[model samples]
Target: MSRYDPSAFPPFAVTVDLVVLTVREHALCALVVRRGEPPFQGYWALPGGFVRPDEGLAEAAARELAEETGLRAHTAHGQAAAGAHLEQLATYGHPQRDPRLRVVSVAHLALAPDLPTPRPGGDARSARWAPVGELLGRGGEDGVPLAFDHAAILADGVERARSKIEYSSLATAFCPAEFTVGELRRVYESVWGVVLDPRNFHRKVTGTPGFLVPSGGTTTRQGGRPAQLFRAGGATVLNPPMLRPEP
Candidate 1:
């Protein structure tokens, strides 16, 4: 044991940026807020800020998520948490990512059921949930870009969502407390950006034991005959996995 360290490590700041995602209008949308101040004032970016010394990474992330989306943190179970499904997405420390200082961002990923429009928080000028393609300049936004390396962080989060739902019951995080199979299928279709065969999707999902529990009810919300309603089950990691169809 040696105590020969005096400021051995260079000064750096930690921040928590969120890639809050939801499926709306049959499209995958990410929560973005317009920066109200400089560096990239007026430019839309992920909702995040420096972590306070007293807060843990998850607490800070959940706080930011609540402030930006007006949805508080609430997870009764790993799959069907009453609130948004949250997890660590990735970390970005490219040195020049943040212009202000040597900053490192521990990014968090959130998968929420359809949510209301986001409200501006912190120094944000405005906030809204925009289609991921638009935010990435793929939906004809006139080449607009996110403030920092946020774009990459968001991309990683999207990929994680697309993949996680395959082997984990995480997709239910995008569904209501009690939802129809079609609703869950739509989540897959939107996030994967591919149309899924209704029959096959239903077979795979329902066939997976401990994935969805019957809610003892049915509804005709999706049209046609009444469809049974179900809730996320206790199982988190879905056995056999729901693989995406090849392109």
Candidate 2:
């Protein structure tokens, strides 16, 4: 047990926020909820809430993810990996980030495989998977800035996903359990916002040892010729990392 002297330091509340991304309609989109209460009522914000007395950072993150987007934490089994991919993103505790309280938010990054719909929960008035480009867009229909420091948090999450996938099997986090190379390419393209040479990208990923395992089946998700289906292999880190081009 630990003790805190009230006079030693000022108290601060803790919260958890999420940057949930997915490839939908071949675009990278983020999960956002409309704030229903004051401070930023009626504005869209990253879905989150204060940490409960008994929960850890990840627990609070998982709980908030479930409450906001109807996604749940991983169970004893690994099936939830097919549902959501979550990890710590960063923390934000700017003195002015929150107007109502002294809040320090531990942010998390989550990737969902091609999810197109979302249900709002907690105090959210509505929820949707809005295209990140538009949410960060200047003058598009979905191009409204998010409330609070969420826009900054989102930009960071996007960059993290973009960078991580280049050296990790994390791109699979944006694809289903069994996906074609073309499907996986689309995930990379959407996240990186770049069009890649199909043949070259195919060669690179396939050549990398243990990067993909053949599922002994094929599908024509891209139409025309049927493509071989594959699953994420045993390797977590890429042997020859897929590097993104300089911006």
Candidate 3:
């Protein structure tokens, strides 16, 4: 036998976990699946799976997203489809995270304007969207314990979304292709969970150079007078970023 040896340690498996977020009935919600196997079977958890050797990290994230949620990644930007966005959230490699083996999970975050519904796939038993605030708290109404360390990962994704909105045009990812300033402000309010003075919000958004571009159009009110329409501008980051209240 040869002297060379390469089996000193156990093999590590890589996984992709997704924090799928959307605004539902004025509340920020996340998609969760009920585990179908051991190690937390029947408990709520994020959608995820083992990565194929042929795929890259992001490709694995996209494949898992499509398999679980029926949403596809955008071909142009390498994010989720238009009006939706996806990006790497963080990586979790804690030993014992997966009792089955040594697993390292690279988590991803996805934002959608709104979705029709979500159905579970792969190893999930059931899937549904739940409010973020409720999932984070314990003993509160609608509060349910999540499986594994998913609660902590979900919390991190929410904070990332909130902070990203302040500087990046990412808030627009929560809106349609075209929307009014009032609508855009609503996105911020819903995610931030704090009321913003309408006048101030309008001023801040408008004054920020290249933050929004007027579509030169208006729409009749759902109840009141007509409102002007606008679309997302070219700028990605807001220099002198808009500030949110302390949490």
lDDT (Cα atoms) of all candidates against the true structure = 0.84, 0.85, 0.84
TM-score of 3: 0.92
- Cα error, candidate 1, residue 147 (Å): 0.7
Residue 149 of model 3, lDDT score: 73
Worst 10 residues of 3 by lDDT: 136-145
Q: Please list the residue runs of candidate 3 whose C-alpha ends up more than 4 Å from where it truly belongs after superposition.
A: 1-5, 139-143
Alpha-carbon TM-score of each model against the true structure: 0.92, 0.92, 0.92
**Which pairs of residues collide in candidate 2?**
none
Residue-wise lDDT of candidate 2 within 80-137, one digit each (tens)? 4465678889999998898987899999888879774778888998888888888776
- The sequence of per-residue lDDT tens digits that candidate 1 reaches over residues 134-228 is 87766213356788888899889999999999999988889888999999999999998888999999998898899999999999988999999
| Best-fitting candidate, scored by lDDT | 2
Candidate 3: tens digits of C-alpha lDDT, residues 115-134: 76787787788788888888
The positional error of residue 219 in candidate 1, measured at the CA in angstroms, is 0.9
Q: Name model 2 segments beyond 4 Å from true.
A: 1-4, 75-83, 139-143
